[model samples]
Target chain A: MEGLNTVGLVEVLTLDGLDDVVRVLRDQGRKVIGPIVRDGVITHDEFDSVSELPHGWTEDQDGGRYRLVPTGTDEVFGFSSPSTSWKRYLYPERTLLIRARRDNGTVEVVQPQPDAPAVAFFGIRSCDLVALGILDRVFLDREATDPTYAARRSDVFIVAAACNRPGKTCFCASMDTGPTPRSGFDLSVRELHGDGRHEFLVEAGSERGTELLATIASRRATTADLDTAQALHGRAAASMGRRMDPQDPPLAALDPDHPRWDDVANRCLACGNCTMVCPTCFCNATEDSTNLTGTEAERWRVWDSCFSIDFSHLHGGSVRSTVKSRYRQWLLHKLVTWHDQFDVSGCVGCGRCITWCPVGIDLTAEITALATPQQSAGRKGVPS
Target chain B: MTPRMYEVVARRDDLPDTVTLTLAPVDEQCPTPAIGQFNMLWAFGIGEAPISLAGFENGHLIHTIRRVGAVTNSLAASTTGDQIGVRGPYGTGWDLTRAAGRDVLVVAGGLGLAPVRPIITELFANRSSYGRAVLLVGARTPDALLYRDELEQWRGRLDIEVEVTVDSATPSWRGDVGVVTRLVERAPIDPENTTAFVCGPEVMMRFAAVSVVDRGVPAAEVMLSLERNMHCAIGHCGHCQLGPEFICKDGPVVPWPRVKPLLRVAER
Candidate 1:
């Protein structure tokens, strides 16, 4: 009752308006970033026009494997979500925290004011919006708000493209964040096209989106169009190949001696790739880099992973010295202790960890194993 | 608040690699720090490290730093007139007021005494409020002992019992020998009515905690300071996490029962 914000307005858009969403956001003085193929991978980066969008591209994503293949249909939102998350834009990997310039006698130390430019997303997925929400709770919800993240997140405008083509690795249904997001975005778009028809069912979740949708010229959606969109969504939800239980017993609570722990440990290299790609992992460490003459120094907060042995280092030595211990900490932290710390779940089940991991670790299988003692014991070898 | 400029008013080399820097803010009034809470001291060109407030006297705050790494070494090397930056009187502090009318047992090992020092000062300043107070300190050797003169003054007090022990002492050394945990067994205090505060290396704290708990002191009455790799005192950075708790914000001074499970796991 006290701290909640008033809900944003809602509206619907016609099919043709999907192409103009970026232009509308840009006219509002916001820089736009969207999906693009870079170095043979579908990733989110700065883009100028819709032509730069990865058209006709769909991704083949399995555990530890990802490939961008052409779908033969000219579709922009056909692919799975990328390896990079909205965190790269909102809660940037590197941030300048403090700067101390030493003159002759006095040292002027200032908390550097963050320069945040308003940015809009062209095609953010529902899982990404959920990840952003989780980050908001961590940074903005706390008493000591992270000044950097708060400044950047304030003016962010999101345009979410609902997942109609779920990736092989996608498990957003299990995480309860998507194939479709109920709310938590400025605008929602379901790109429905096939068999000589090309259109998008756009729904506004915020006043900004409602105003922007009014600028694009398109007809009101017929009842038939809405029915077609609903059928497409139902089919997509069923097509999702991956599934995970966020709170599977023994593993979700992370029973330490569960034999599966040792099996996962043996396969886990502790390379930190999973954490790097995980949408909800927010661990960071601060470092100070001094100038050559050493008169001035700047404190930088950098991206850090729990898998690194140096992460748990205290005075004597690392608390998690072995690969087994480190892997245990990372998984336990994600599935179990994170809930204890944040109240909300840490994972959005985007499956980036599964697709990006070099060792092909699937969290869905890991969670399923914890269902029974026999299953945990049976899965001894790492999935190929 | 961000770190403001502070000058090293005076410096004292208490031991070979340990030094105490008495700091005073260059401009504004620095707030009084609480017992068991720490300050993130920045060494001009080097990084910041969290050091417990050793003492607060007159217009200066004293921090006894051990030169273990780059940041602390730079801070320990700093002399009078050198300027450094300080922020935060951060994290939770000891609950000395709750220990009123109860015997207070203070156990410290080596640099661990730095954090427990403030509690001792508070106990002495308001001696009538609390029951009998006992301080048992332990170090690696006789030379490693800190605050020699103040320890003498505390020993002279009729109201307090101060005992010092070193693992190995020089031939000239004269005091108790062995670990501080051993001293807790024979310490003069009412165990049932006593509150124990411990700060030390993790192994030593665990043993000291067991000794006090075995003496009939409830586990809830035992307070221990947890140390970790603290990068941010405000708890944004994830370096200081111990299980679900962040050592910087949730603790540095947590009740033993609260952290007992976290402390029990070797590599959690």
Candidate 2:
């Protein structure tokens, strides 16, 4: 209860002040990772320099399209969120589980090394934060707490920046993931503009964030600054170009034979780009590794996607052979059934699936297409 | 010093296409496994597969496997003295203590027999502790029934009722010819004093649960072993998740009432 009510706030930072914050976090031995402009698209990658940050950049996205363009402002946090997220730092692409050696007609079992990296993930959005919370239901629940995920998660701190600008594919408002996060972050910042000056309003949500904020050179927030922060959030909400049906049973509308799935399957590449960029998708596959000596071998687990044909393979054949079935499974599991299974909706409404998809397979559009007649007639064909 | 891995000492081609392998712990003292639990058996160079204990608890561990996947096909190809690694007898198992003093109904359909067989053996070993024991087994055909010779021995015992059936049958075979649920309909069970455990295909268990519940058995009194794609026996892997309950943890043995909602969904 103490964690819920204790909202901490502070003086806003200008665009130029971001480098100082990164320096302070890195000086504390944290690996700072964020969206960096690469090959024309803003993507998540390791960063040590403020120059690598996507400054004066904006993304254009629609069903089956994504593009990076120059924004008129020099503000580093002025742009909308990226298509990728911070889940990669918690659950990597691959990691070893066990190693074994056979000698003298006997075998030995060995445990793999644990991750101990302290991470400071910058530019995390509210939807991505909610996605992490849904994942926490799986990886950190009482029955099966993933040690690898837990180790990385506990050592990390989040520096979530609120959405000042939303892309065409953005829909965090409908999902309530937001223009602002309710919980699951150490710190959140809302960028504000006042009389030709840009400033970031800061709020600490956890003790780790409180400690990190203590090192930052900032005074406490005034009532007027709070009003400015609220006004900034309202502007972001008004600018939202995408919205999902807040009332629609979150991803549950996707049926195996849903006509909407057939529509997307036609343009979809089955390249798994959507899942790769998704912050909450946690399906994985395993592999066995052998050392050069042939005497030592290790078992490894790696991220996998349901879009792959082999993801649901049975003995003689694959259960979901077509792109249609795979897409249906992905959407339904993320939205509807996940609620029944895990008591949480799988999607955080980050809009990354809509943005990064090469063919621009918009999830919100598909859901709208599948929306029941009563909802469609009343809600103007789109939930958002 | 390293932890010792178990090795397959002997392999017996038991029923048609089914092989029984004996595993001996590499260490002098083997970690004892529990009834209704399973091991992640890995072929030396291939991969791992989950297999239930067919014979063990008397010390010599045995696994009855049917050649199904890449790992299983390779495991079936192993010689009598081939070596492999064993991880766990993980997850919560059948609470045999809960079944004590009650008449127990142990139903198996095809390969489902392997997982619950050890529980039957344990039940028989402590025969007087329970009221009565019944085993109703159904396979695809006569040739597919596992533990045939053992079935005969259990049949002769006065303490247990053992019956076999097949969905389809050969001309020479003269056993009950119907689905396993048909056998359940004819059997007389005192639902108040009985606890039924069902394992097999989802359809078989679904039908069997209907029959058991019709006989006045409470939903909590009937248990089913679910089969899911369990890559990691540890609860961490989401592959085996069925609702909030991880099939690998909350159960591979769950009360019918607990899993009814999940079973309705197509994905699970």
What residue runs in model 2 are displaced by over 4 Å at the alpha carbon? A1-9, A205-220, A245-270, A291-294, A319-325, A340-342, A368-384, B1-4, B28-34, B78-82, B95-101, B167-172, B191-193, B213-220, B241-245, B257-268
Q: What fraction of the true interface contacts does model 1 reproduce? A: 0.54
Task: Check candidate 1 and list the clashing pairs.
Answer: none
Give the poorly placed runs of model 1, Cα more than 4 Å off.
A1-16, A250-252, A257-259, A369-384
List model 2 lDDT by residue over B46-156, tens digit each.
677778777784466899889988788877877756676776776667778878898888889988898889888889789888877888999998888888888878888
Which stretch of 10 consecutive residues in model 1 chain B shows the poorest summed lDDT?
B259-268
Interface RMSD of each: 7.3, 8.1
Q: Give the per-residue lDDT of model 1 (tens digit) for B1-268.
A: 3687889999999899999999988987467877788889987767889999998888688999998888898899998898978887888899897799999999999999889999989997999999999999999998888887788899998989999999998998889889998999999999999999999998798889989998889889999998988877776777788878888888889998888766666566
TM match of model 2 to true structure: 0.87
TM-score of 1: 0.94
State model 1's lDDT. Answer: 0.81
- Candidate 2 lDDT tens digits, A249-282: 4344344444555677898889998888888888
